[model samples]
Every structure is written in C-alpha cells, then in structure tokens.
Target: PPRKNSGVLADAMENMATFAALLRKEMNAHEDNDHEYRKLEIWTRGLISSLDELEQSWFAAAFYRKSVIAGFMDDMSPVEQGDYARYVYFYKDGFIRVFSLLDKLGTVLNHFYDLKTSKLKTHFSYFTVLRQLQLLNVHPALADQLEQIKNSYRDPLENLRKRRNAEIHYMNSEMQDDLWQRHQGLHDKIQLEDLDSHLEDLKQSLEMNCKTLIAAFSYSNEQLRKEISKPKSVQS
Candidate 1:
C-alpha cells in the first residue's frame, strides 16, 4: 500500500512553488537582475526535487520498519532480516539527504545574500554558512530564526550527523551499535536499537528542515518584493 504523504512535505512543496512563481515574476520585472534571479531559480528547483526525494526515502523507511518485529537478530526470520536491511538502507538515505538538501539551500542563500561564504573556505557547509550569517550580521532576522531552529533540534541533528559520518566514513551506522554491544561483552546475537525512537528523531529533523526552508524562502521573497517595488531612485 502506498503511504500517505506527510503534511510537512506537502506544505514545503507548496511554499517552494509559490517562491518559484514569485521569483519568475520578479525576474521578468527586473531585467537588470535577471542573472542573479536565474541562478536563484535553478537552486530553488533543485531544492524542490531534493525535498521530494527525501520524503520518499523517509516513507520507504517507515514502511519497512513496520514489517520488522524482531528485538534481536537471533529471533528474526530471514524475511524479517531482509525487511530490517531495507529499513536501514532507506533510513540512512533519509538522514544523508537531509544534510544534502540543507547544503544546497546554503549555496542558494550564499549567492542570494552575497554572504561570500566561499571566500572563507573553498568548500563550505550549511553550518558554516549559518556561522557566516552570524559573523557578517547579514539578515539578522533570518539568521536568528535559523539559529533558533537549529538549536531547538540540536540533539536530534547531532545524532543524525554522527550516524551520517559513521555511515559515510567508518561503517554502516546500524552496525556501529552492534560494534558497541560487542565491546560490552560478546553476545550470541545483536540487539536492535529503538527503531521507532530513531525514526521519530528523523521525523523531527525533517520537520526542522522544512521549517528552515520556509523561513528562508519566505523572507527572501519578501525582500525581493520590496526591492522590486522601490522607486528607481531608491533601487540599488
């Protein structure tokens, strides 16, 4: 059965569409700024697609998670093992995409606000961009809002980041728990972590991601409209 899409995902998609429409309208109105607006348009499109993929991965993970009833590897049937593997795959994909989407947004914000984050580092991340926002004191309202969102979800985001690093650099994230268990004492079978709790954390992170995106694009849209409406003498 197809899982129902989350409202958070749906709202983000809707807001992105509105932002795109406004951006195109502004692009046509302000011919002198077409180049900058065009770049923003491309990034916005990419964000929309990336967000859709993240939601799909999350849904697939939830679907597979429901099929696995075993508390430990020793009690699982072969089918349950396969289901758990699928769950882990999609879960990992979901968390990795969460950061990937944010970094892509960082690129957009960097160019949109002329933050010059690239000058600070050849390759910078979303967190770095956030820091630049604070350091530069550009768009203080947006920066404060984003900072609040990040801080509110700090614990979950940190957990996801550790899993992401482990999955990418060390070993499969799920296996990290198993490795720790082995250090505790040799066991006949591996115990499963709290899958539901982990998924809940991922869900919270996704909500945080959606809120950050909305805050950013909404503020940008307002600023763009103000810039467009200003008299030619006042326009920059």
Candidate 2:
C-alpha cells in the first residue's frame, strides 16, 4: 500500500503554529485582551487537530479504495464489501470534516475581526463569514485571497457540499448516487460510484481548505504583529 503525504497539511500546520505563538505573545502584552487571545489560541489548536484527523480519514479512504476491486455490489466478495464500506465511511468523514474545519476557522475569524456574522444569521457558515468580510469592507486582502481559493476549487467544493448535505439531511451519499442510477434503469447489480474520482474531488476540497486556513491565519498574524509593534502613549 502506498502512503500519502500532504504538503498542504505541513504548510497549514506551520502557519497555524505561528499564529498560535503570536496570540500567546500578544496575550501577555495586552492583558485586557488576554481572555480573547486565549480563546483564539484554543480554537487554533483545535483546528490543527481537526486537520490531522481529516488527513487521516482521507488517507484511510484512499487506502481502502485501492483494496476495492469490484465494480458492482453484486460482484463484491465479502472482504471487498468490507473494504468498500470502510472507504465510504472514511471518505464521508473526510468531506464532512472539511466543512467542519472551515466553520471552526470562521468562528475564530468572526471573533478576531469583529465581523458580527451572528447578527445576520444565528448559525452562520464559513461562506457567510466570507460574505460578512466583504460586506463590512474589512480585511479585503484576506477576503479576496480566500475568495479566489474558493473559486479555484468551486466545482469540487460544490460536489463535496452536495454529498455532505445528502449524508447529513437525507440518505447515505453513495446510496443517493445509486438511487439516481436506478432511476436510469433497473439493473441486475448496483454499480459503484467512481471511487477514484470522488476521492480526487475530496482531495481537492482538502487542499482548498488548507489554503484557506493558511491565508487567513497568515493575514491575521501579520495584523497582530503590526498591532503589537505599535508604540503606546505615555501617561502624564
């Protein structure tokens, strides 16, 4: 079995670490903002761990996908079926975590930048936060960069979002595809979705997410650095 190594993951982890370190350093300098910075640090750490889990899920899915040889459910041996099931489980987990990780990032961005996204919608999404950034005309550089990344991976992200919604709100995502195939015609054996292609989309989504986080944290850290560098006025 071939192992997968993600350069994006490495970059994201390093960027996030730098952001956390800056948060800690600034917390000491501005005691009044210590609580807020502490919360941001915790969230950043959580994002790092979540990214690790998402990567593992993606790797496991790819590994199991390699083990699956059957094209249709009826043709699968018991072992192959088990492998397929594992692949689906991990693939679904990977995509779901992609959005989950972004939402967590959104929460941190909202707090740090004072986006006030909650007022517009109680349970706002990452996309909503992006919109809020634009609407308020704050952090335009970060907002623009993030939007470009989102647009670059729009197709894959949209596909993943559909699957995520299906898995969460309706039936199993794979089964939803199977049902569509059934609508085409009643076949003797149910065919499998394109596991490799779906995995590729998932990989793209993961990369998009990694890039988004890197851009966001890098920009935020730069802002923090500027703030900390500013000189304070002396009291008489």
Candidate 3:
C-alpha cells in the first residue's frame, strides 16, 4: 500500500478517460499557425497512444494472471511444467509493461515541460523529468502531486527497475546471481521461484504505473483546458 493514499488510483483512472475526451475536444475546437498546430497535434496523439498502450498492458496482465491461476490447478499432472512457464511469462509481461509505461510517461513529461533544450543525447528517464519539474517550480501543485507518486512508487520501482535493466542490458532477470548461490548450498535443493511474491510485486508496479499516468495526464489536461478556456485576447 502507498503510504500517502489508497483511493487515488481509482480516481486517476476515471480522470484519464475524461481527460482524453477534453483533449480531443480542445484539439478540434481551434486552429493555429501550421507549425504550432502540427506540433500540438503530434504531442496530443502521442499522449493518446501512450494511454491506450498502458490500458492494453493492464488488460493483458489480467489475462495472463488468469492463465497463471488456472495453470497451477493440477499440481502433480504433466501440466505443471506449463504452469511454471506461464508463471515466468506473467512476470516478464508485467515487468516489460511497467517499464514501457514509465518510458511513455517520460516522453510526455519531457515534451510538455520542454525539458530537452539541447542537442545532447540524454535518456529521458522518469526520474530525470521529476527532478526537472522540481527545478522548474512553475507548477507547484503538479510538482507536489508527482512527489507523492514518486514516494509511493519508490520501493517497488527500485526492484522493478533493476530487473528491467537486467532484462534489457544483460541477461534474463530470472537467472539472478543470488538464485545461483542458493542452488550451490549444501542441500543443493532446487525450488520453484515464489510466484506469489512476484505476483504481489507486479500488482504493486501496475497500480503505481496507473497512478503516475493519471497524475501526469490530469495535470496536462488542466493546463490545456486553461488555455482553451482563456479569452482569445488572453490566448494571444
């Protein structure tokens, strides 16, 4: 459970749907210089795409979870092998979705805040944008909200981040050095990895990812709505 809040995740998901509708309405309700309009269009499309992907990931994880539960039913049968495989598959899918969702959020944050100012090639990590938000200090409410998310997500994200890096940059995350150490013990007992623990972590990661996206797009939607609500003279 997040130390700060529990109900925010549900509210955030609801806000996302409303926010997406407002975004499209704003886009269609106005016109601007070709370059500026094109840029906004592209950015808005990217955000919508990211949101769609995030939702899809959550749904897919649910499907995989069902398969995992059903797979474990006949413990002593030949299907046990397939069940173990499905268990690993769930973790893999969950971690990958978690990482991808973060990256998508990073892109939106970077673009919305104009965080990238130079030609230097730097990875736009989620933390990178959070630090930049603190330094900018332009949106105090958003900064504070993001701070809450960062705090809530910190511990689980630490574990997920390491596993994601291992999978992307090195080798299979399941083949950890610690697991090898355990296998080398005097008893030399090989036990199945703890599916329950992995499931809990994955659930936490997914929840956090949803909260982060909700906070971010909620902020973005507020800003855009403000722009649209302003008088034409004020907009100019």
Candidate 4:
C-alpha cells in the first residue's frame, strides 16, 4: 500500500501516468475508425502532450530547488547580492514553468469546448472555459466535478495569475512585486523574498494543475467511452 499524500510532485507524477494509460487505451480502441473519433482523439492527444510537459516542468523545478539547497554557499545570506540573484533565478524559473503548464492546460480545455469559434472570442481563458462548462446545460456531473476543482484552487490560481500576467506583460514577476513593496522610499530596506515560499507556491500550483487535469480528462474519457459504445444511429 502507498501513502496517499506521499507529496504533491509525486502525486502529480502518478496521476499523469494513470491519465496517459487511460488515454492510450481509449485511443487504441478507436484506432481503426479514425474518422469517427478523430477530433476527440486529437483533443485527447493534445491534453496528454500538455500533461507530459507539465510533468517535465515540475521535475525540472524540483531539481532546481534541490540544486539550490545543496550547491549554494552555506553561509550565503538571502539578502546578499550574490545569493539573492541565485534565489531569484530559480524562483522565477519555477513560477514561470507552473504558469506555462496552467496556460497549456487552459488551451486544451478551450479547444475541447470549441470556445475559439464562438462569437465571444474574448472569453477564452481557463476561467472562461470553466464558466462555459457551467452554462453547457449538459454534462452536469462533469461540470460539477470541474467546478469543485476550480473552487479548490480559486485563491492560489488567482495569485499565480496576477504574477503570471505581470511576468508576461510587464516585467519579471518578482521584480514587479518588489517594486511595489519597495515604493515607500525605503532604501536598504528591500526585503528579499524567501525561496522556500516561492517553491511552495509553485508546488501548490502544480498540484492544482494536476488535480484539474485528472478531473477534466477523467470526465472526457468517460464521455468518449460512452460516445464510442453507442449504437450507430445514436452516434450521429
């Protein structure tokens, strides 16, 4: 027997392996009738690829954290110029990877629901996809499950989203936050961020990403199985 909460990164790795197997089984079942399940299969494959990248990103971030701890100078203070630079480098690396994974997942969900072709093209973020799922009026159970996932991550995701936006559209995310915090005419009082805290935030975001994917893909796989099993007349 395995401990259920071995760790977030470990749990994410296991869940992704499970999802990959499930997706492969589904794809193989429809291999010969390529025309029938092509679009759904494509969407599923995209999700699987994204999950692969997400898993890789987590692994890289974890490695970076371990490296930082094991290799950095033992006496280096966090606020020291040299030490702070190293800490910021890894912190930014990890946070951006988590954010990128989330965005990739969002793209898949958006495509899954055909949100791009809708008249309201602007409504195309992951949150938008979640909202659209709510309004679908079908897949009530699946929608409920996804809603639960969204609610579970509401706070962390919002925080990460703001940092992500700043990183993408303004400046380095850490610098952006630091700038605002240091704006009160406080020289030599600049507070260095704790690397541990940033890693924790990234880990939480990864966990949320993993959980959301498991829920969404599990539901999609179930529907796909049902879709594939129906009588020919009912399919079209």
TM-scores, all candidates, are 0.91, 0.93, 0.75, 0.69
Provide the global lDDT of candidate 1 against the true structure: 0.87
**Location of the lowest summed lDDT over 10 successive residues in candidate 1:** 1-10
Tens-digit lDDT string for candidate 4 (7-37): 5445444554554455566567545364424
State each model's CA lDDT, in order. Answer: 0.87, 0.91, 0.64, 0.60
Model 4 misplaced regions, further than 4 Å = 1-46, 55-90, 97-99, 110-117, 233-236
Rate residue 18 of model 4 by lDDT: 53
Error of 2 at 146 (Å): 0.6
lDDT of 3 by residue, 1-236 (tens): 32232365555555655665665566677655454434545554554555455445444544545444332233434555565565566577667777766776676677666766222337666776777777778777887898897788678777877887987898888767446746688345345445566666677877787677677877877887787798765463
lDDT of 1 by residue, 31-116 (tens): 74448777788789999999888878888899999999989988999999999999999999999999999999999889888999
Q: Which residue pairs collide in model 2, if any?
A: none
Clashing pairs in 4: none
What is the alpha-carbon lDDT for the whole of candidate 3?
A: 0.64
> What lDDT would candidate 2 get against the real structure?
0.91
Worst 10 residues of 4 by lDDT: 67-76
- Once fitted onto the true fold, the runs of candidate 1 whose alpha carbons sit more than 4 angstroms away are 1-7, 29-34, 231-236
Supply the TM-score for candidate 2: 0.93
Order of candidate numbers by lDDT, starting with the best: 2, 1, 3, 4
Model 3 residue 115 CA deviation (Å) reads 3.1
Of models 3 and 4, which has the larger TM-score?
Answer: 3
